[model samples]
Target chain A: MGNVAYAVLSSDEQEVSIMEKKIQWETELVHALQRSKVEKRPILLDFHNPH
Target chain B: MDTVTYPQQSVVTFIEHNLIPLRVGSDTQPLASDFAVTWTPTLVLLDPQGKEHHRTVGFFDAEALIPSLLLGLGKVEYDSNKFKEALGYLEKLLAEYPESDSAPEAIFLTGVNRYKSTGNPLPLKEAYEQLQRMYPASTWTKRAYPYRLLG
Candidate 1:
């Protein structure tokens, strides 16, 4: 039982680590544009299909 | 892009450090029309004032994407009259990823920036020769055809 529990915890930790590597995309274009202007950074607009 | 490209460490770090990344649906309003994005998964890089400097359609892997983004950043600087800064980015792309999809464009633009800054046609001539030698069949080589007449 302890061994099974350890395996589950390891799996969960691996899942979390994978999730953490994904990019956190900003959803609001207006806000992103404003922030980019303020931050003096270029805006990378990604037009993607939700479907 | 999310599952394959964006998850790469180098791509994520580059975007985070140099760009304000925004993801929107293709159907998103005036912004989509403003950029004339007719295709899904189109990536457009805009200057701070919302002027577009570069765009690419379709999906790209991390290796292809980085050089493209770097070229866009170089164009942004070039459009802003920062020729020296633009050359720095373009030269770096050429040095590191000479075979990248964006490399031909970077090489072409390096010549343009050099000519613009130094008022010498030699760089343009060299660019034309390089493009002809390295990417004979590429459209970039065709675009540099006019430079051949400069001699």
Candidate 2:
């Protein structure tokens, strides 16, 4: 059953990676804008109350 | 947003693929005033050049967010004179999420693109009809009211 255990661990790792792929929020608006200019991607600015 | 909406896989994936996601607090400097954000949870989509394309004030589930962003992207393309590409995104948004908040805007822009492309009033008439039928009370329908006079 050693192979089975390894398979289960691999599946968990893959799931973790997928979760990690979720959008990373960049806090610095200026830096994000700069990156957007460099990357040629539109900016999705989410303004919200943290409280 | 962090606890509910933004964490959704589809929302995250779409944003990461199509946008440079930035989170700013309401109190954040010049950016907030520049964007004219008067409420919390105002999601603004801007072109790479920093022009505001679309803004929605409130929380949006993944289902709602994607189409709104697509509409903004479509407008950016439209503003850049990429009519065909803009239509592609707008049409997709309408097809996939006709019930979305952005649907009216997409419908309106689709007609504008069609008119820009062929210089014909038929598409605009059809768009006007669709808007009247689907969202008669929406501001988009009101905005498109003049198109009815074209034919």
Candidates' C-alpha lDDT:
0.89, 0.87
Give candidate 1 misplaced runs (Cα > 4 Å).
Answer: A1-20, B149-151
Provide chain B TM-scores across all predictions.
0.95, 0.90
lDDT of 1: 0.89
Q: DockQ of every model listed?
A: 0.70, 0.59
Estimated TM-score per prediction?
0.89, 0.85
Error of 1 at B13 (Å): 0.8
- lDDT per residue for candidate 1 within B26-78, as digits (tens), equals 98888788888799799999887788899999999999999999999999999
B1-151: candidate 2 lDDT, tens digit per residue: 7877787888878888888998888888898888887898998878777788778898877888899889989988898899998999999999999999889989999998999999998889889999999999999999889888887
Compared with the true structure, what per-residue lDDT tens digits does model 2 show for residues A1-51? 555643345887888876665688888877888989999888988898967
